[model samples]
Target: MSDLIHKDPTCFPVLEAAGLPSAFLDAIMDGVLCSAEAIMCIPQCLDALCLNNNGLQAVRDRNALRCFVKILTSRTYLRALTGETPGSLSTGLDELMRHASSLRGPGVDMVIEILNAILKIGSGVDASFSSSEPASCSTPLWKLMLTGAIR
Candidate 1:
């Protein structure tokens, strides 16, 4: 069965299609990593989207985020994070953070990393509003970290 699955390369065309744009993929991956439910669907959706040539922009649509947030905010995602399943939102965030560290060139990865970090910290306070709050207020912290504003 394993060999049969491996022999038919089309069995996973999404991974191949995901080769589109690295920047877009990075953004979509970052969003999925931000939520637990979305993380569980990552492999399947990634495969399907890849087969259809759907790029990162397709995943960036407002409706997509709405749907992702709905699932993310649901009890299912929270339960999964609590150990009801193998995929946890924290794991996805960790993977994204690691990717952010290895990224080169422009500051997209840095911005995303900082944003995710702030969001994670805020999540502990209010999981609901954490997603809705403006990120601008968080900029000062980044400035402090980068410029040593406090020390």
Candidate 2:
């Protein structure tokens, strides 16, 4: 979470930073905002935190990291990202996993599977994608688990 927040400000330090392209910043902003929305919707905040961490780890580029974090922590953006909600669990985590699994694409099913594993492990599990390929694959899935979109 700290990584995301700390890096977020760089998304747009100035209207014209010269080196920092507007298009790149825009893309990062979109990804960050999307991630935040996913986090808030999910019941498990901790899981969201974990996912942010995992995303941070997945990419080593400092600029990209900063953009992702900035979008996530932006209060104005976060509210819009979550949108209006009655605050109710319309679906279980398992169902979400099934849906994620059903999706066809590279990294799509993998993301869902990872989230399901995270829900099962909860915070008690301490692992990183660097530790193992299987573990790395699970990180994004865990983030999804936090969203409560998967069982």
Candidate 3:
């Protein structure tokens, strides 16, 4: 399975089409990270969107934050066939497989890693809040999303 993420062609899966591309998720995570704001409000943003259907935009006076927030708000937003939920192994693994099969866009990988350093992961106060992660990988979000269950 790690081979899939690392793209180890020697042991690549024989299955057909994977789920959402890693780069897309990475892009969203990267945007959230690079905007350089405190994540103390992410849980609030998430809750407001989920509870009130409030617009993701203007939640924190940033238009860029919407995409990142929307992607995080719903696991199945970009993924329909796979039904990828935020914090579950069955769904997240499927998301990983899908990510492995797809191609990635460039830039922002390092920024997300730095962003992860800024955020306090496993804070245990909220599920929507997440750790910063490398923009090239999908596992960080998946792991962060699943941490809610673990807590």
How are the candidates ranked when ordered by TM-score, highest leading? 1, 2, 3
Model 1: how far residue 5 lies from native, Å: 13
Q: Which lDDT tens digits does candidate 2 get at residues 1-151? A: 3233235534323412443233433444355334434434432222222233332222222223233233332323433334332133123223333433321242344345545554444543534311222323323443344444345
Best by lDDT: 1
Residue 17 lDDT, candidate 1, scale 0-100: 48
Model 3 worst lDDT window (10 residues) = 101-110
Task: Provide the RMSD of all predictions against the true structure, rounded to 1 decimal.
Answer: 11.4, 15.2, 17.6
Off by over 4 Å in 2: 1-31, 34-103, 113-117, 120-123, 127-151
TM-score of each: 0.29, 0.21, 0.20
Q: Total clashing residue pairs per candidate?
A: 1, 15, 3
Top candidate when judged by TM-score against the true structure: 1
Segments in model 1 whose C-alpha atoms lie over 4 Å from true places = 1-39, 55-57, 60-76, 84-151
Q: CA lDDT, every prediction?
A: 0.38, 0.34, 0.32
Clashing pairs in 3: 18-98, 19-98, 116-132
Model 2, residue 7: what's the lDDT? 51
Give the better candidate number (1 or 3) by TM-score: 1
